[model samples]
Each structure stands twice: as C-alpha cells, then as structure tokens.
Target: MVGFYNSLYNLAHTHLNDTYELLTSLQGRLSPAQTTTLMQSTSWDEIIFVSQRSPRKSSPGLDGLPYEILDILIRVPCFHGLILTSQPVRFGSCYRC
Candidate 1:
C-alpha cells in the first residue's frame, strides 16, 4: 500500500515537472493581440454562461461540488465577491491564500 502511494506520487511529480518545462519553453511566443485577449478580465456574464454550459451532475469535482451547485453558489453576493477577488477558501483556514 505504501509503495503504491509512493510510486503514484513520483509519477505525478515527474509528469508535472515535464509539463511545466514544456509550458515554460512556450513563454513569450504569444502574439501581441493574443496577449491582450488573454490579459483581459473575464466578465460575470461570461462566467455564468460557461457554468451553464458545463455538465451539471455527471462529473463532480474532488470537493464533490457539481456545476449546478457551483452555479448556484456563485450567484450569491458573498461568494460572488470571493470569486471576483480570487480568494479561494482553504479547508480550515480563514484566509490562508
């Protein structure tokens, strides 16, 4: 059991490092127009539209929050504010991030 976990961790770590290197090599290759489009802030309508288009109950995330739940949660003012500020909620911390 322990060996399985260790091997899994090692495989994930190696893959992530390789993926990071590949992405790093592609840096500064974007056109000026592409960079401008990527840098633009996403609008609320865009976010809501994406959420609506996503699968509702078929694939829940690790946190078990489905797109439907997420869609509803984001509609609330407080959660909406958190999303806008980009402050993710830590498991038990008030504001670690």
Candidate 2:
C-alpha cells in the first residue's frame, strides 16, 4: 500500500512539472506583436461580462481583490486604460487536492 501511494505521488509530481514546462515554452513562443494585438482587441464589455459570470464566492487572485471589486473596477473607464498599459499577466501555481 505504501509503495502504491509513493508511486502515485511521484507520477502526479512529474505530470505537474511537465505541464508547467510545456506552458512556459508555449508562452515564450508568442511574439510581442501577437500579445499586444490580443490585449488591444479585448473589449471592456467582454471583460466585464466574463467577470460577471465568475462565481462570486471564489477566492481572490494574486492581487487579493475579490471578483466583486473587479466587477466595480471594470465599470470605470480608467480601469481599462490601466489594464492596457500594465505589464504582461503572470500565472501563479495552484494546488488542488
């Protein structure tokens, strides 16, 4: 039983590492122009709509601001400008049971 558990843990750890590496490589291949175009083409209305669709009770992101705050921020014109000028977004690791 213990050996089985150890093998399972190792397999999961390896899979997670591989997935992260693959994502990093893929992101590196995206050109600056492509990223800029994507950011510029995104509309504020679409962002707000996605935010509205998010679960209200979900935990806050790295900024520690909840979805409700984000919803309010998206309504302000300056918020959209801030997002457009901000540095490229980074993804944080999430651990699940």
Candidate 3:
C-alpha cells in the first residue's frame, strides 16, 4: 500500500501534499489506512473545487450540493460521479464504460 501511495503522491505531488496537511489537522481521527483510502478515492477536481469555494463561501453551494465544508466527506472521485446524480449520469456514466 505504501508503494501505491508513493506512486499516487508522485503523480499529484502538490495536491497530495496539501491534502496530507489538511488530513493531519483533521479532528475526525481517521486511521492511516483510511486516510490513504480517502486520498486515493478522491479526485483532483473535487479537491480544487473545495479549495476554491473555501474562500468564496458561495451561495447555495456548487452544483446544488451541500456547503463546501461537507464536500470533504462526500468522498473524493465519488463526488464527480455524484455531480451527475438523479439523472442519466450515474457513476462512471460519463465514460460510457
């Protein structure tokens, strides 16, 4: 798992660094494995979205979802699938795979 994490870190070094810092400061008390899982499960897009929204406190939130603070728990990568929710756009629906 460390090897896999290392590979992912290499692929998204800066973003992963920011995520690691945030995770360390979290009060939720997630285990190391859980943290890794969260990182691996999340998408780069969601991370950026949350970071951007944090500063704005956008009204009604992005994509009609909950506030940006809750976005962290929405599960990375998963939120991308969720963005197309309640319609023809289910998980992995965009790729038609």
Candidate 4:
C-alpha cells in the first residue's frame, strides 16, 4: 500500500511537471499579438452574460463563494468599474478572492 501511494504520487508529480513545461513552451511560442489577445481585459457585458448563463448549482470555487453570489456581484457598478480598469495578466483569469 505504501509503495502504491508513492508510485501514484510520483506519477502525479511527473505529470504536473510535464504539463507545466508544455504550457511554458507553448506560451514562449506565441506571438506578441496572440499573447495580447489572450490576456485582453474582458468587458462587463461579457462577464454579466457568462455569469447569467452559468449553472446555478455549479460547485463553488476555491474561495467557497457561490455562483449566485458571483452573479449578483458581477452586476454591481463598482465591480464593473474595477474589471474595466484592471489589466489582464493571464488568459481566462479573474481577480482572486
């Protein structure tokens, strides 16, 4: 059992490292324009639309914030302003809780 666990751990670690390396290589190969497009700041309308479309019972994220709460928060004027003014550093990424 101990050996099985060790082997599983090693396999997971190796897979994670390989995935990271592949992502890094792919990122390095992207053109400046492509990277810019990927990191483009999203619009409030787009966010609101996505939030509204999301399944109500979907699992909560790491922060344990509910999807319903996010849906409500996204419509707030201050939140819209913050998202509009912020710079995007990564693809499909949002502010951490």
> Model 4 over residues 1-97: C-alpha lDDT tens digits?
9998898778556777787888877744878888899898777777777777878877334445567877776667666664465443355777554
Candidate 2 residue-wise lDDT, 1-97, digit = tens: 9998898878556777787888877754668888788767657667677888898866445656678887776676756775545433446853232
RMSD of 3: 15.3
Instruction: Summarize candidate 1's per-residue lDDT along 1-97 as a digit string, tens digits.
Output: 9998898878556777788899888967889999999999878888788888898675434556678777877777667766655555667865322
For residues 1-97, what per-residue lDDT tens digits would candidate 3 score against the true structure?
8998888768555677787999988877888988898767545566557556664455334334445644554455555554434233335555331
TM-score of 2: 0.41
| Candidate 1 lDDT trough over 10 residues, lowest sum | 56-65
lDDT of each: 0.72, 0.67, 0.57, 0.68
lDDT of 1 at 59: 40
Off by over 4 Å in 1: 1-28, 58-64, 94-97
Winner of 3 and 4 under lDDT: 4
Which one is best on TM-score?
1
The C-alpha TM-scores of every prediction are: 0.55, 0.41, 0.22, 0.45
Q: What CA RMSD would candidate 4 show?
A: 9.3
lDDT of 3 at 69: 43
Count clashes in each candidate, considering only residues at least 3 apart in sequence or on different chains.
0, 0, 3, 0
